[model samples]
Target: MLESLYIENFAIINQIQIDFHSGMTVLTGETGAGKSIIIDAIGQLLGQRTQPNFVKENRDYAYIEGVFTSNEKINTLLDEMHIPSDTQLIVSKKITKDGKSSIKINYRSTTQMLLKTVMSNLVDIHSQFETHQLFKQSYHLQVLDDYCGKKLSILKEKYFNNFNQYKKLEKEYKQLKNEELSDEQYDFYLSQKNEIDELHLDDFDEEEFIKERNELNNFEKNAKHISQYKNIMDSSKGMMSLFKDGLNELASIDSSKIQDLHDQLYDAYYSIEGINDDIYDYLQLSNFSEERYNEVQDTYFKLNKLKRKYGASIENILDFRAELDKKIQYFENRESVISTLESKLKTNQENAFKIALDISKLRQENALILENEVKEILKDLYLPQVDFKFQFEKTNLTENGMDSVCIVVSTNVGQVAKPLQKIASGGELSRIMLAIKTACQHNENNTIIFDEADTGVSGKVAESIGKIMKEISKNQQVICITHLAQVACFANHHLQISKQLKSNDTNVKITILSDEDSIIELAKMISGKEITEQSIAHAKQLKKNNV
Candidate 1:
């Protein structure tokens, strides 16, 4: 339920706060009292789209905030917002002159659409303009469904699930069974995969192999210029013998000083010996030949060929091979897949039919009850012979289910109840709309805001509509914007919208009336601009009688 609303700088509303409760809180005022402006503000706070022109002249910004209390479902939504419910949810909207609107729920930044969805469950603003989806031609089916309640809803859910499941298998079956793959593309992929698989290459460190191959190439080029250092040193008795001779000569000069000189020379000789052994070993291992070079070159060329046909690297080529294998296997079992999917699709269709049949049956039952209830409501409104019925059309299986339902009505006695869309009179439309609301108000949770639903109605009919709105208030909040004093007279919580010329501007305002204020206002509505004593007395008598 909506607890309260605070509006500021919102089109002549400068600032107004209204505390709301669980019954019908009616707004009654003279023409152009800015009642619609109040409704519009509430709409904004509830996440309804707003027009820029709604901002008051010279005002930089407009703000509206709504406070709501929720149930279990609303609590779950609060969890998504990451905010504690704390028994109250506040939604606020600020529209600036720059055409920017900032939306917030419980002070958390939010989008208008999100806040609107949340608020929808909490408050339903039924406007004065007979703009209800139920009244509109396009919304006939939805109204029937709502009246059917959970009976139809559950069946519809089951039907839709089956329908969707069938669609899934049907789509896959179509893709696999109906597609014609190109022969060239298939052969290309198959050859690529087979070629990569045939490589039989060792999973050695490729980086290391390349390094070794480069080293081999270098050794092959420099082999002739290299010499066996140890063989030369031994055969010619070159540096080794000379170094030994120098060490002995140093030893003879001074025993201690010569010993140090010999030790240094000995160390140099040992280092030279190690270097010679390494050079000899490397030369021995070089086995480089033109034939081996050809082998390496051919392997590089083969790998490159695979890369162009498949991918840039060995790892990527391997992945592509895996994909091709899966696709080919799918084609191999294409018949089996189609067979399985066809069975599933058939089974799903059967399930959907059963569910949709169940839903249709329940709607048929509920439709009878709803029609009777509407007839009763209409009887009270002085149309005892009104013909009303719920009409159903069967459509192809849809997510919303197989039943296409609508509300049908005929104002005159013995007339066939055609679809509500075909009825043209405003009075009949208004009455039938109220009749439907009266029938299903028990299931709806949001506040019922009716703006001039009583238009083109008067006398006992007007009085009955007021009584019906008042009755609706017992279960849900009812806000009726009305031109008729009779309807306004029945409001338990009456608010009035009136306008005045101020500072060369027309300003509108709303006021929630006390009983005394209501009577005077009702009299003004009853008697027009000139309120005579007799009309005021009549207004007084009407209130007295209702009380």
Candidate 2:
């Protein structure tokens, strides 16, 4: 239940704090007294979208916050969402002049989605416009499911999971069956595989082979140059012999001076002799084989062809081959795989149907109870001859199940019930929504606000609507914004909203009325601006009778 609400700089409501309690509380005011402003502020706390105009004129920002008493369900949800809190939940909203808004749950900043999730367990605001939701068939199923409680919910969870698995397997089976290859295609793939497998090219590195082939191109020219150098050094009067003769002559001329020169000449002669021997060895080793060259060329070309067919690199080509192997294997065992998947799908289908059947039974039983209760409530709302029923039809499997629910109604006796959309007026729809809310008993121990729920009814019917709201308050908090005195007189707590002209500015004020003040407010509602003795007496009598 909501403990209190504090709003500042919101529209004409400059600053106000309203204390809420567990029972029916009604906010009654004249037209243009800013009653809906309070409802809008509460809606923002529930994470509804806000506009820039929501802030009061000349104010930079607007602030609204609600303090709610928490329960175990709310605490558990907050813990799961990592939101910090104590025994109370504080939901606040700030709207700036720039049309940007921020929401906070327990002073921890949160997104609108999270705030909505939290508030859903805390309050339900049934604005006047939401009565249209009663005409939707899907909404009917949802309401029915809520009324059925955890039994249907558990079965629905299992059914949806099984349905998802069945869909996945069906998709896989169809894709594999579509990919079955013909005999000719299989033979073509086999031939390509053989061509690549026969090469044995994995043992060879193409880069290294290219390097050796290029080196072979330089072999002949290199050998010719080495032969010329060797012939020069090995001649009798060549460099080696000349060096040897010089060393001997220099040694004989001067023993000490020529010893260093003789050592240098000896080193030069041996270096030239070593070069000649190495060149000769290299020339002998340069014998090239045409057969090996042809073999290397063939293997390199075959590998390049395979690379072009598959990918640019050896690793990519190998991965492609693995994929091909999977495809071939799948087609080879196509019938067996399909049969297996079909069996699994059948089992899943059976399981889904069995669970759906159980869920349907629960819904059918609950629908009858709900329908009778709604009819009883509607009877008190001055809809005495109204016929109400829950119509269920078989539909294809959906996330919910194989049932589609529609609320059927008939306004007159002896008439067949039809879908509410075809029969219910705005007033009837509002009463129906109230009936459902009262019957379902969803969201217990939380605030349920009706923003002008008594829009299109008057007289005793309006009083009856107020009585139903009061009864609903036995289990939850009810806050109603209404204009009818018949409804406002029945509130356990009465709040009167009034507008005043203060210093050339329009201001709104809310006062929690005492019994005497409540009677005066009701009299004003009964007689408009002119409150007379008769209206006051009538208002007092209305309150007295309800008490």
Candidate 3:
């Protein structure tokens, strides 16, 4: 359960701290008293999307934090995430005017998605808008699936996988069948295939070919430089000839110092000669020729043209060539491949159908139970004559399954049941939605918030709605924002929200009303600003009866 909430600079609420208790707690005040603002603040704590306008008029940012008593499931999740688990959990959110937001769980910075994951089952808030979703037939299937929970989810996973495989094989089969080529098309593909096969692309290296082509393009300039270098090093009047003549003259000296100098010159002369020999061998191996250069240029042009027509790279070209081979092969042996795909598609369809039938069976069984429970709850909410049922239709395999569900209802006796969107009035819809909510309540300890869920209800119907909420609170926490005095009398705790002007700025304030104060507030709700003796007595009697 939520222990307390602290909000700062959120909407018109400059700053406020409100404590929540387990049981039915109702927030009541005059219109525009900021009751919905408080709900929005709690939504932020639950990781709902925030808007820039959420920040106060001149405030830089909006902040909201909630302290909750940890449950076993939450603690287990925290352990998995390597976060320390304690009895109390602190969740906070901050939104700035610049459209930036941050969330933290126990002061540890986390992402909005993680916050939502942690808080998803901990609190369930149903606003008036969510009640309208019942009109959508799609939502009806979702509701039934949610009621089935993990049993249906696992079956759905298997069906979805099988269905996807079937679709893939079906698409491949269609494409292959459509690829029947005429004689002219077959000839064109065969020629293209032969041309690519002659290239031996498996051993082709485009990078190495380009490198060799660049070297050949600069051959004339390099050849001229090589000729000049050979003349300077190996010509008769060049460095090598001059050094040899000097070494020969030095060898004739007989003095000891001259012998030492001659030995050093001998070593240096041979080192230079070895380097010259290596250069001569390299020049001989080059063998640059005009024929070879022209051959490389022709290959380069052919490769570029292939790239333009088939692909932009060697890998893509090879892929295109492989596809051409398949097309040619299929034209010659089309029946065999088509037969194989049909067999696989039939097997896949059977497997998917089996799982979908199992899912539908489970849904049919659970639908009966859910329908009975909804009718029972509706009877308590003063719709005793209501008839409700699930209408299921077989559909093509979709991600969800092959079942299409619609909820139909008839609120009056002797009336034929029709689709909910067609037959149900606003007040009747509210009661039906409440019945569904009660029937579909999960076993988890969730804090359920009703933001004017009793909007189109009043009189004894409103009182019954209050009673149902109070009964629900016996297991889970229930917070309601209501304007009806009949509902307010049943709250275990009553909070009065009122707007006050401070420093020429509107601010929202909340007060935990005492027993006497609650009675006065109920009287105001009953009489609408002119609380009379009769209204006060009526409020007292209503409170006494509920107690």
Per-candidate TM-score against the hidden true structure: 0.73, 0.73, 0.71
For residue 381, what is the lDDT in candidate 1?
82
Winner by TM-score between candidate 3 and candidate 1: 1
- Models sorted by lDDT, best on top: 3, 2, 1
Give the worst 10-residue stretch by lDDT in candidate 2: 212-221
Q: Order of candidates by TM-score, top first?
A: 2, 1, 3
Candidate 1: tens digits of C-alpha lDDT, residues 1-547: 6788888878877777888877777777766678778888887877777777767778999888888776677778879877566567888899987768998887888887778777766776654355446556447667678777776777777777788898887776677676666778678767766777676544735576577668667876666445654545755577777777877777677677768778887898889878877876777775677787776667667878877977898787777877677557556676675677788888888898888788878878888888899899989887787788877789987776677776677878778887665763767767777787788776344677786788788988998988888888887777778888777777677777778787787766667788998898889889887989998998888788654
Superposition TM-score, candidate 3 onto the true structure: 0.71
* lDDT accuracy of residue 238 in candidate 3: 95
> Which regions of candidate 1 fall more than 4 Å away from where they truly are?
81-83, 128-138, 187-327, 443-445
**Which residue pairs show backbone clashes in model 2?**
none
Off by over 4 Å in 2: 181-329
Cα distance off (Å), candidate 1, residue 481: 1.5
What are the per-residue Cα lDDT tens digits for candidate 3 across 338-360?
A: 88889999999899989999999
Top candidate (lDDT): 3
- Local distance difference test, per candidate? 0.76, 0.85, 0.88
